[model samples]
Target: MTPLGPLLLLGFISGHLTLTRSAKILTVVLVGGSHYLLFDEISHILHESGHNVSMLVQLGNPRIKGVNYTGRNNSYRVISWSANEEYISSFNSWFLEQQKSFFEGSESLSTFLKFMGHLALQCELILGDTSLMDSLTAEQFDIVLIDAFNPCSFLVAEKLRARFLAVHVSNFWSWYLAGLPSPISYVPAARSMLSDRMGFWERLKNSAMFLGSWLTERMLYSQFDHTIRKCFPPGSQPVLSELYLKAELSIYNTDFTLDFPRPLLPNVVYVGGLLSKPARPLPQDLEDIILTAGDEGFIVVTFGSMLASVNLPVVLEQINAAFSQLPQLVIWRHLHTHWPSGVLPAQNVKLVDWLPQNDLLGHPKTRLLVTHGGLNSLMEAVYHGVPVIGIPLFGDQFDNMVRAEAKGFGLTVQVNQLQALGNAMATVIEDKRYKASALTLSHIHRSHPFPPRQRLVQWVDHIVQHGGRHLRPFGLDQPWYQQYLLDIILFSLAIVSLAVYIVTHLLKFAVGYLCSGGKLKVA
Candidate 1:
């Protein structure tokens, strides 16, 4: 061949190799709300990075209505299994009832266990669908990224027989599942709502919470096990806990700048603020409102997506009353239709059906954020250097608020204490310390060598290109007793006990001989 012909052939070969290097990634989205958003973000990132990405969306929650389950606008394909309308209505009703119980302070262990049962039912529905399973198996995905909030994702990964990575939306569950060391002496438990700096009683409470959480997790696993056995062949059924350890990596949606310092394995990566971006110009209407507020600025109030659906008239009145006391404009995320019949929003408060949360937080005129303490919102607040007043509702929200408060960037008021909402907002807004700490945290979070999205994409690419087996710790494969070194401690204790028994006998015999003037005493 001529020189030019050889050069053209070489370029063609290089392009082919680059295309072949792209991995086929299947993201399992079982639930919705923030969990779906996180997985969607990951799918898009991987797809943008030249990977073949597909999303497997199994609708489990009715609350996730109107979401684009399919990657319609994206280049990747989407395979979705939507639940029946009746089932969706039932699930939505049950979920709202649970929320009501939580607001009324009547939520019990039984209610939580019942919720776990609901999750199991949803998993069972997906697994029972033969066509869906066949379609997923045919894809032959290279790896799976699972939302670790629901145990069902583990079973899905197992059914696909693919190496998987877990995306933990909160700070704590993945640590417990992956056998990562979490010292209850300082590290707070999942929903304990306690900070790392604990006195004696607080530490005891943390320890108790950890044990309770472990037990609850086991119970949840057992519920999933029934589905596993029912769906899979006898020998092929995989243990949920084992699948958790089998994850190549666990990406936590948290950062140390916002979360308390804790032990992490090499395979664990913190990719908080994946959805955060630089502020874009707000719509003219919102801009005009901000301008009208002058130097007093504005406050953003949102109780997250799901909580916005909940109707707490008393709580709403209290919030409106509190916002009325402020000089700043309050842009609250609440449906105009859902507004209470008689109650009216304060003159300073602007009620909208939806608001651009990240954009609002990033705005120069934004002063404080009144949130329900979702991790995503908190991370955005930290990213934008905005102080918060958390009105934590449930789940990890309480713990997240605790961390925010411990970091000195915010404070929390319980839902029952809506009366304190105004005062808490005033404190965070007036005190320069909170804002300074938030700015410092933002600096630390942004000062990383690479951004969180970059870290997520790079680490995921690294794991997919090269298996993460070497990155996993040996302890992940060990039994619980071995992981804690309980077996070694027990063996050492046994040896020490035997030696003491012999030594004590020898000493007694010597004393008896001396006392008896060299004559042996008969028993």
Candidate 2:
């Protein structure tokens, strides 16, 4: 092929050929931690493309946002993920196994009070500090596209009454943002049944996740309602439920190419792979190290931002015991200084504070990765054709790992059990099936034309240009229990019981009166 052919292909992928103008859209992006990164990154691209974007960074510290929207320079900003202030250790409690936290704690009265307090703090911090409320009312945004975690967006959305679009970082949170709560954060279940191919137990596992999430979120929202009621006089809560329910449309940060049987809603859009930015140059030493590994391939181990350097004592020892003997080079990320005793670092065992992940994964010497099963890491592996050995800690990690395992992409390690971790990783390293599966998914993940950013930018433009209100779910107009209908059935049954009782009493009275002067006696 001529050089012109390569240039044309590059043009197509880079979106230099078919780029469109972005709308001047003001959006309240509610990022719930790193989960919001993909949407933020892509939407930023849209901002650069030609639209105006205001990012509400509800979760993460400011990283250099990926790119500007197509025609417009990106104007990225942060918003609080929730309408509540979360201090250190406050957010950590979500990883609590029993599913109990301030949001789901035993102190009903206290939890209620704190959530209310948190809401005020949230309003003051998220709205007041961020100047979100003013921006909403003054800037008069056409739409509000929020991350799954950003409850603050609901209030601003109500104030602005803009059209709302929900951007789900993944399926698990999508369930909650979709008004169907979930306990597992990593596993994004579909809205429909094609996902049932994972079988009954898997589905049951998903249901359990929903149960946990439902119970917890219900508590917080209820508390949030009480707090909102307190903050404003009667009739001024600004449609708090709307943010949770009124997403005109949803952008899923998942590639359908990888997650098959992806159940979609009419309002939901699949805009995955929006965060793929081509990597920078790799260091010479790193390239040489990778080349040295050869056919045996190398392993990249990273635990995402949330649970870095947890108190898990056994993890280090087990990793050392396993990696020391292996021919492949091992790259591990341990943020803390503490290392397990008696473990000498072997030539193949490499420790890093951090490594250029995308670069290494794309390298010829790379083969496998050992991660905590973060969606970000999972996407990275699939995109780079590197299999994983997952050590799932909590949230959606377990579910994500399970899906990867099902897809033959990698093995999973139990967080606490070192034996399980070692065994699971062995399978990943020894098995070529894992590598093959990962490569297939990589091809699928990248097959989409125009990076995810282009799609997101277009949608943002559409919402802004059309007025975002039209992008909402008709379902949100219904009340909570009414949407589920459990209360309606119960209420109907109660009415039937009352009618039955009245008829029975009247009939008995008539029968007695006909028989004996209409007088009735108590038993």
- Which numbered prediction scores highest in lDDT against the true structure? 1
Task: Tell me the tens digit of each residue's lDDT in model 2 across 256-366.
Answer: 555645345555677765545455677777767667777887888766643343434444666677777677888776543544445566678776655776777777677
| Highest TM-score scorer | 1
Per-residue C-alpha lDDT of model 1 across residues 398-490, encoded as one tens digit per residue = 889889999999999987888898998999999999999999999999998889888988887788778899999988887889978899999
After superposition, the stretches of candidate 1 with alpha carbons farther than 4 Å from their true spots are 1-20, 60-72, 521-523
TM-score, structure 2 vs. true: 0.71
State the weakest 10-residue window (summed lDDT) of model 1. Answer: 62-71
| lDDT, residue 176, model 1 | 79
lDDT of each: 0.85, 0.60
